[model samples]
Target: MKKLTLFASAFLLSLGSYAQQALWGGTNLVSPQINEDKTVTFRIHAPKASKVEIEGDFLPPTKVDTPFGPQDIPSRAPFKEGKNGVWEYTSSVLPSELYSYSLYVNDLKMPDPNNVYQNRDIATMTNIFLIGGGQADNYMVQEVPHGTVAKVWYSSPGLGMEARRMTVYTPAGYESSKKKYPVLYLLHGAGGDENAWTELGRAAQILDNLIAQGKAEPMIVVMPNGNGAQEAAPGEAPNSMVKPSFMNPKTMDGAIEKAFPDVMKYIEKNYRVYTDKNHRAIAGLSMGGFHSLYISAYYPNKFGYVGLFSAATSKQVNKGVTSDVYENLEDKLAVQFKNAPKLYWIGIGKTDFLYKDNMDFRKILDNNGYKYTYMETDGGHIWKNWRIYLTEFVPLLFK
Candidate 1:
């Protein structure tokens, strides 16, 4: 019995020693520690890595002059390594906002493994952190009455798609109340899916907060997957990750325009949405803005309010289009304006690369005598400006 006990003890000691070695050799790191002063500190455990760097929208914008125009890119900072192969960088005091960041270990970029809150924009994914108590605080989930965000699968026979998915946001009291609410079809930009509005744009929180404060009317927000070739976001769709070329700008081929009617049909059939032009609104960012423009023009009498944020305008639409659609663009605009939407709003950043394009489109509107509300703010083509556009635009809707 003594010999047996000694053997068991020896085995246990060996196991414990192995565990200690593993713990010492491996890295268990906590990242994006939000300091009390609103400065954020990021950490990475890459002991043998030659270099580490952090890049994010939280840093100052880097201005670069491009052939088309001046462009503002997100700033990047190098991280200093400390004891035990840990690298760290603390940012200056930043405004209240949601920021996405990624780390580069040597030359490979990756999200912080410690942070479960991450967002995928286009082809890249990064860790996200929120700094609270300002305009950005509105973006955070708060104690206010919340809304229900549903990931729904519906059939779109018109687009030849059977199992498409979209996200629907119903305001608080939607289930309890029998009253029908106005609908806002919120579209996502290129490379973004239905999840973009809620996950990255913080649409739910913005609507919830605005509605709770009585600043805006309670409305149903529909976020549809604008990519026609795919059913939903990356992992949500079958073979989506593998065949994402459907999302490529070259292949999109005005699929969103063709598939829009199906989106409306699904929403009107399933939800308690008001079925009137006056109560219906459409808005989008970037490529979505182009979709909004084309959709509003294609079915001018359908939507009462139209908003375009940092829109890709006529320049993009006129590319390689010899169809009747391109031929009658101006005539279609005339007809669209004749219907007279309640609000035809355009919002863009002054420094946005698309600024000249937007200005050119505005000139066309000006020459045609079509009335529109144009808002230009600081910053470039970033979510920061898009969020501001949403906040200011929603209050003016459904009035």
Candidate 2:
């Protein structure tokens, strides 16, 4: 047994060493240093492969006009191969957001020889590189003013999952300080898990930037599993049912009161979080936004701030406002209508499918005497819109 352990350790050490060497090899992986013009280049030495393409998040499917010239959505950017079969391409202009991309070697997905910063959402992870002026820090992993992110597990009797692990971002100064930061419960959309916001939304970076700018108040952000199912991270299409499991109000309610409480209690006991109404907020996108509406409106005392980004709410439909409608709806919206929270923020893109929803919600707010801020931008349901929303919303928080 001792010999086997030593051999395994030695094998891992050798693989690490080999990986480092491959990174340093001049011909294989070449990190194309991006220029001031935001133009970046890639060089892949795949001489054995008949075809090679460079894929990245620099442009949209229709807007792809790189050296490869107009490829499909998530298409391979063509590379000009050399005498030794080394392929290369130069980008038009890359954005500032972190990107994940890879090489398609004869239709097989593979990592870029030159690129680094590889991460995984599930077992199927991707590889890509960062192209920006100064990305010395992994902004996504940086600490929020009042929190630290820790991966944890909680038992869910309702879902029948023995113990489900999830990620939580505890605010900074949580330890050693008697002060408790407000809790901001965030949820991901469909086809995403608890790690979605931390991974792709760049929530930590947005909080850090907002806190630095003195726009947002320091707070704890909790990301929990929204699906009331055994599947931790399901695919785009969930299992077909006579009626979707998620549509069951009893199941969602049970999950919220039971599984959600398990996560909450764990956080409250383990971290320094406030236990008051003013110090708690809830927000999400898509399905997550639906959860926020149900949870927050039902338990209004728990959250002092509520946000809906491209929300999917029945209350938000393009119907003209009237006093009779307002009277009948005030009770459903919860709260005293006039004095609900510190802020009720709704954000949507003009081009987004939820644009009319935002407008309708604003009308409802106007009719019911409820107060809110409706932020409209030029984007869609993609990460671009979400990131922009975070940039605008975080600054308005904790004030």
- Judging by TM-score against the true structure, name the best candidate: 1
lDDT (10s digit) by residue, model 2, range 1-399: 999999999997888787856645445456565667988777777788888786765645544444323323444577788777777778887766566677788888887756665755434456645544443232444443435677677776656767665667755566667877777888776556677887777777666656655677877788877766534434422352222232323223325533456666767787777777777778888667756766666555677788888776653331342222223344647463434788888888765666665677678778867878878775555555676666666666667
Stretches of model 1 off by over 4 angstroms after superposition: 1-30, 64-70, 243-255, 315-318
The numbered model that scores best in lDDT is 1
> 1-399 in candidate 1: lDDT tens per residue?
999999999987888787865545445666889999988888887899999989999877788888657798877899999998888999999888888888888979888866778876776778898888888877988899999999999898856878999999999999999999999999988778899899889999999999999999999999988877677888787776553432454223555675688888889998999888999999999888988988888888899999999998863644775434334667888999998899999999988888888999899899999999999999888888898899989999989
Error of 1 at 279 (Å): 0.2
Candidate 1 global lDDT? 0.85
Error of 2 at 21 (Å): 8.7
lDDT of 1 at 52: 90
